[model samples]
Target: MRITPDTLEIGSTQKRNKNETLETFLKRITHVSLVGKAIVLMENLNFCKNLNVLYLYDNKITYITGLECCRNLTRLYLQNNAIEEITGLDVGLDRLNVLHLHNNRIRRITGLHLLPSLEHLKLDNQRLDPGEQLEFDGECLLALASSLRYLTLTNNHIKDISPLEKLKSLESLDLAVNSIQDVEPLESLLSACSYLSNVNVLGNPVANAGPPVKLRQRLILASPTLTCLNEKDIPQVERMFVENMRHAQRSRRSAKDHNHTRDQTTSLGVSGTAGVATPACQEEKPFPHLPPFASQYRDLMLSQLTKNTATERRLSDSNLHISPRKVASAAEALHRD
Candidate 1:
């Protein structure tokens, strides 16, 4: 079935009355079910301006087309099809909320930056050529940062999920039975996207072979907002303990970072005094401050360096020297020129 105007009524949920015109019939169509119809080309039916939900799964649809008129479409099911690419769902799909394109031949997931209201996206079991890993579009990820909530990329053999870190609104993520071996990117994603509630990564060659308790502990530490992991519900008491552990670890991490920065400063100061080297140089100026630092500390550092340079007649001062503050004061010469 090629979805021509005459054959379009075969799967329509709307009934054309005895005297109803084609325009009126098209307008009345809010749902269409053409599953298993072996639809090779998606054409015609462009006048379904009021179509809300469409079901075209389990068919031979090779490409996504002719949906530009379904501006009111919200739920679209194109799974279990032969869709080798993702398109035709971008233009004028402002109200689309759910899309199912799983079990297709799509290798690169793209052309979805236009759907700002998209919430649920399923691209599981993508049929790709051998030695092909699922890829994502950067622009699409950025557009879905705020609107996307539920995402499923299961069985796609995706390894690096670092690109999904910007999807901060994700609440439930399903990456089960994939090839993800590292949870570091997932941890980073959790750090940015704190709204994740249910996450599934089972059947992946992750650290699941370890002790169950250890794995549970690691997941709990990874995301405190999670209530379910690999389809297993986490108890409230366990969540509390994990939150406490995360807080403790966060405090320890903060202290460690502070000490590390201080140690680096000390080492760099000593090296500068010995006329060897300093912190990684992005510039060759008087400021010996490390190039990589939090922006909020820049003001404090600038004032300190200016005070040291003006008062003590030295361009820099650090922990490398003794009695750094006792050297001189800017106010010492206040009574003079």
Candidate 2:
């Protein structure tokens, strides 16, 4: 059987190899769009039976019905096809390991369990709107979970991925834009899959749910191998933590400020006594009146009292308003006083 010329069409490289066998033709050709008619001709030639790899992406095929004849097929590239359903794939292709169905219209995954050897599966652009159905869509995912090691379901409508725990062998999983919020799923992943090393939840609510530092800490504790986490979207948590520390420092500052004010007030009172003392005799009667020192003492006492009162009022304010700078300033002020 001779592989057709139309099936080998690729850019200016569309020249046909008339002498090649059907199997050689399919194997040599790559990056060609296999439309429905070309696929039918290939199916009729029975040439795909011995084929180990097939590139049928960017095609007009609506279903996976044509690939049943290629039983020995190990890698199938059917990306950018018009296929809507994922059923009826059980066939002679038991050796199939890598299936790239990216950019397909597949709404549901139904017949994926048949390929027990499947190691890496990409349904990234299927737009699977698994409404209400939280976990794997029935047995298909269950079978995959049993053998699948790497899976990418990015750019889909998948919401609750807690079901991924079923994939005991999964090592790398990409669920970037899902609607999951809680970090509870991490626990399940850690418990079920001991080898899980990487997880990308960058654009989801879970990323923005908590403090980045704290979240990073918790994730590190959960999986020491977890090298990356994307919780930076939660700016509020970061801000809140900063605000809390600022408030604490402010409080300490106010306390210091109050103490400083108190010391200044006491010093002023003692200094004022210097001018009011008698001539080392009859001092008990009290010196006549206010000297410059006494005036200075009075002004100093009033300023100290005012500062102390202001500091107390500020300390009583909400802890949210305090800042680190204020605390340091207060400490310095207390030292000077």
Candidate 3:
């Protein structure tokens, strides 16, 4: 059914169709839903100052306006719309606690700095390009950092999330189906947001980098306080076991590298010592008292005597031999000649 500003009670129950004035309607109604009506603009809602919950989702609304009088609003659902930007929400949403803006054309996260009481925010399924990262106004988010607890930005083409480190009170975060390729930024969240326990990164590149079991173990190791990952609860025993295993692996690798380096150093040292020792041992002179020329001549005479002995052996085998005295006499005669 179509519901316009003038015919606001078209789809409402019979109690709200009792021909009541706008003031009476505003005073009695606490919740309203004008969904699936192709609504382009929000009007005639200024009298709804007492409204606590409003659902205007699945419409063609291009902007957020006409809600400045809803100061008592706590929950707002504006998802599945054509909203290109977030504005006009700084007026009367101080009491707003929950906001759902999923499936919209929003590219930048803004218009939330004044919402000091905001707790849960969902902005998933935005109209973003491939490889396009979600941008944020750090100052705006920082203003609400303390009050924000649950944040869902899934499937928004987001890659960098360093700005979220300031959300110290954040408890649950959903960042699935994005382009986050690194888990280091998330590690910071563990320390910054002491209360953070649940995290969803199911469709990111980091999640697909390894097997599911290993990924879970790595994430658990990264954040020791994490109790849930990708909607699965992580038991304390599993976390402890993964941490211990990682520690043991690191120790083994370190020891192996150390031993390898030591072995290489020892082998080099032994080879160097052996090379020097062989030369030093051989350099020790056996005949230090002998003159340099006399030692050389003595070594030559011994070599000649040894050659004569071998020649005599060969001559005897042929039935011919020379006596030692004859050999000596021939040597002296040759020397004289």
lDDT of 2 at 200: 73
Clashes of 3: 0
Model 3 C-alpha lDDT per residue in residues 70-174, reported as the tens digit of each score: 889899999999998889889958899999999999999998988989999999999876656677888888988889999999998888888888788888999
TM-scores for the candidates: 0.71, 0.56, 0.72
Model 3 Cα shift for residue 128 (angstroms) = 2.5
In the range 53-155, model 2's lDDT, one tens digit per residue, is 6666766666666566567777777777777767546875678889888787776666787889999888776644456222356677788877788888776
- lDDT of residue 115 for candidate 1: 93
- The Cα RMSD in angstroms, rounded to one decimal, for candidate 2 relative to the true structure is 16.4
lDDT of 1 by residue, 242-303 (tens): 77887899999999999998777666554455564557742233434332332234445556
Which residue pairs in model 3 clash with each other?
Answer: none
Global lDDT of each model? 0.79, 0.62, 0.78
Model 2 Cα displacement at 33 (Å)? 6.4
Q: Candidate 2: where are CA atoms >4 Å away?
A: 1-45, 128-135, 228-337
Q: Is candidate 1 or candidate 3 better by lDDT?
A: 1
Judged by lDDT, which candidate is best? 1
